[model samples]
Target: MDKKEISHSELKALIGKSPDLLLIDVRTKEEVDKGKIPGSIHMPVDSVDRDLALDPAAFQAKFGVQKPSLDAPELVFHCQMGRRGALAVEKAQALGFTKARNYAGGYKEWSEKAGK
Candidate 1:
């Protein structure tokens, strides 16, 4: 499988350009309470497999957001650092989200460059 990685700046640019993009925060709830990239959906890494396994309608009902289609334009995952985000992206891909990617810099680099 082809894995993709996005940098902070690239993700910011894509956010502006891609209407179909889905930004997922795979951090713990406590970590997420501190802060996160604006507009990111909070889906902890640990829940990804179970959540993505649900059918699209059920997934949306549970998460309050549309389930990304297999051909969704882009789905970017991030965590406090990068490891969990990479894992989340892999899980997304395994579940057939072909456009999934890891935001390698994650929230740490984002906060540094974009401010808290």
Candidate 2:
């Protein structure tokens, strides 16, 4: 499956189906320190540029785990809003992640979903 953009509702549905899906928080550590969706991996967007951008295999060997293998289990990226997370999804796809998607509306959208 090719990577593509995903909205908040779509991302949420994916999360429900695959709990072990790689939920990547593309926000900075400080930003995420405030709060983040549960079970997300902290893969700062910058880190991908430094190491993973240069050599993803090496990055995985050192800082990342094996790429998630489920087709429906997407590599979902989210930040405060959609832009950064959308960029992160593009990077992840460039780095050979076949199932990456952005969580547009991100944390704010997620919080709203939880309330509903």
- The segments of candidate 1 whose C-alpha lies over 4 angstroms from its true place after superposition are 1-3
TM-score per model over all chains: 0.90, 0.72
**Cα-based lDDT for every prediction:** 0.87, 0.72
The TM-score that candidate 2 achieves is 0.72
lDDT per residue for candidate 2 within 1-116, as digits (tens), equals: 65466777676676657756677788888988988887777888877545445454765686565545434356788888888888887776676666777878888788877888
**Which number leads on TM-score?**
1
Q: Which candidate's lDDT is highest? A: 1
Q: Model 2 clash pairs? A: none
* Model 2 spans with C-alpha error above 4 angstroms: 1-3, 49-65, 69-73
> What's the distance in Å from true for residue 33, model 2?
1.2
Candidate 1 positional error at 13, Å = 1.0
Q: In model 1, which residue pairs have backbone atoms overlapping below 3 Å?
A: none
